[model samples]
Target: MKGRGQESFVSLPRFAARLYNALTHTQAIERQHREIARDLVARLARGRLLDIGTGPGRLLSLVHELNPELELFGLDISEAMVHLARKNLAGLNVNLQRGDIRSSGFPDDFFEMVTCTGSFYLWDGSEECLEEIFRILKRGHSAYLFETYQDFDESAVQKALKANLQQESLVRRLVTPRLLMSQLRMTYRTNEISDIIKRTAFADSYTLDPTSLGGPPAWLRIRSTKPAARA
Candidate 1:
């Protein structure tokens, strides 16, 4: 079991692993998303908190720093990411694991809160993943899904462009347009994400909040819950 997990980690592309933090770190919008996620977890997370796609575990680390009493667990598919996350979260009692969200090995009703940020589009099995999340969450508790879309509102695109121009260095500023274009190519539409959510076990058990992260209008949040009693 451990070897299988480690194998996946070992196969992570070096550049992808290395570039993950740098790309997210310099962006104003990325920082806003991370802050919003951390705040959400701090306010609502109790008992065990599991953060999926916890690349470098940055957001989890921030949440732990703010609310030291909450237990933290992080799961990511990349070995290099887990390694960096371990180092980033060293001294904290965080359980960092390498795994896929569609088939996490945790027991049913285990986690009090679950969070996935900035990685939903990478998931190939969105329905399965949501089902897995629903299975693991304690009844009456919820999972938070935060994603940024490519096809954002016009106002959001303008705000993001202005923020990038102001905050990034001159060289980095020149790259913003290209990067944003690439992101748009890869991102899913808001309706596409919502449709995936509606198709899962969490159908009719979730709420969508667009632009709540206060950055790009492209940022959307979904709060999905497991019913207190199975019908």
Candidate 2:
């Protein structure tokens, strides 16, 4: 049997696509509604930005709108999803590439800022992954990670998915929420994730819920920095 570590890369790309066509064909559109009206753009002003797990690139579009001069690079695991993001965001000055954030090949101190939305919980190597992000980013560069906080256990869910993941496309998967939920081995609490980030070497790590923004339950944001002394 292959390991979860070996399979995480494969599962990530399919997660968004399958969730869309499988769970809800209009998932992207639904996400657009909540995000466009949300504090995501206000939190991520402009200039050099790295968008991790940039599913379909709606957040990219929003950031661009917030500031046209924003130089944005997007990375995701799904090639097909990248295509959709490219097509959906045509004529805009953005660089969207297919890559796993776990190994983004950009040089260190490259970006002024970084952001991930709806995908942080999917990461298998949390501390290591953040260290990589910290490595590539300039000191004091801000990062925003928005993910589900109220409904699941981050570890157990990923563990189960890493085991029985089907090798299929979104059109083929038609992945139901029930099917996905069943794979989850545990439930997650916000403080559980909060404690993980707070204990990391990264400073200023904190969680912001919907109450922090007067919004919905699935909303959560973490703001952090790479220690300037390391520079």
Candidate 3:
């Protein structure tokens, strides 16, 4: 399962990358996630912000637009995705890199805010990745992780697909209910996600906010913070 999940991102073809960017542009759920992430970064982000698994860099671009003064960076495991993101974010005052989240190699207390969306479920070493995120984040700052649950709204997904693939019958046929369900199986439940957070450095310093994400019940956002040093 881990190998398959890793392959899904690492081997993303250029055509598939274009399709993903188009879907995010047209899909309602994807749009909402981007909007929420942008708003959160705009409000809470200061100094430097890093976005993990920033496929195509749409959310990072949005956040940069909202907070033009913010220093933004993006990392993705997929070289293809990073290429696409670099193209999408060209001349936007953003830094894009290709790397694994488990070993980001950034300095400690680096970013004021961090975010990961839609790709958290693909992480095979989630605990290590969370710990890496915790390490890079400045003390008292936060990282937000967004993922879809097993019971995520099927209707919205179908609607989003239909809206995005209106002219591509073959694409619509490929995105079947069975395929969606199978993909959902790769994701962790809300409690399971919380448990993963508890095992990380952010244990005892995180919030599982099911209501804050503002989408389907199965859509969850985990806000985890690194504590400030004792005085």
Candidate 4:
């Protein structure tokens, strides 16, 4: 993230577009990333899905693999992201909303499936975000959370903190997922992300095997369900 190549264009308005271009433009690297996205989106297949932190709506296309009738929606805080997503998915019957997942304007039980990938770990509170996920999902709804887990060793994280990526810029040296999770005091093991869901409004939750996301990345994908009201 040093040179003006891809790092300089990320100035709020062009941030999302830059993010999308960086991932999609890389030929040798992008296919693996897309395949990983494909797997995560497919596993949470359900009607009326919502994508959180959907950077440029690339993964939203994966819904095509599921029942064609399935509906899709996405939310992102970046205007550039919104514009790109709208343009990229114009022909499809999908809804693209510009909003924050933490304070989403949607009503309760609005969707059957909710997905937040490649961006959930950037948020401030893991618990609060989980609550918001539960609130917006319908009874018996399922949510898929994709994020980075802090590793045990300190060197692995210290290396990512000094990057110049948008969220991981130099000014924010400790911006890597490892440092971010540690700063947030999130001590849950990778396996415990699911259990964290069950302790909330969701009644059941479980972890899937480490999915092959096809990138030089280590991401955690956890699925959970919101149960019907207790008697």
Clashes per model (N, Cα, C within 3 A): 1, 5, 0, 0
Per-residue C-alpha lDDT of model 4 across residues 90-109, encoded as one tens digit per residue: 88888898776668888888
Clash list (residue pairs), candidate 1: 9-79
Kindly report which residue stretches of model 2 are placed more than 4 angstroms away from their true locations once superposed. Answer: 1-40, 43-45, 151-187, 203-215, 229-231
lDDT of each: 0.77, 0.62, 0.76, 0.61
Where in model 4 is the C-alpha error above 4 Å? 1-11, 27-46, 152-199, 202-209, 229-231
The collision pairs in model 3 are none
Indicate the worst ten consecutive residues by lDDT in candidate 3.
Answer: 210-219
Whole-model lDDT, candidate 2? 0.62
Report the Cα lDDT for residue 20, model 1. Answer: 59
Better of 1 and 3 by TM-score: 1
lDDT by residue (tens digit), candidate 1, 1-231: 222133434478767777756665666755665677566765574688899989888778778766777888999887789888898889999999988887999999999898877766777677888999999999999898777676677675766677756867876666655665675667788788778888988988998777646455666777898989867
Q: Rank all candidate structures by their TM-score, best first, as comma-separated numbers.
A: 1, 3, 2, 4
TM per model?
0.86, 0.68, 0.84, 0.67
Q: What is the C-alpha lDDT profile of model 2 across 74-130, one tens digit per residue?
A: 887777668767976899999998877777888988888888766666666676677
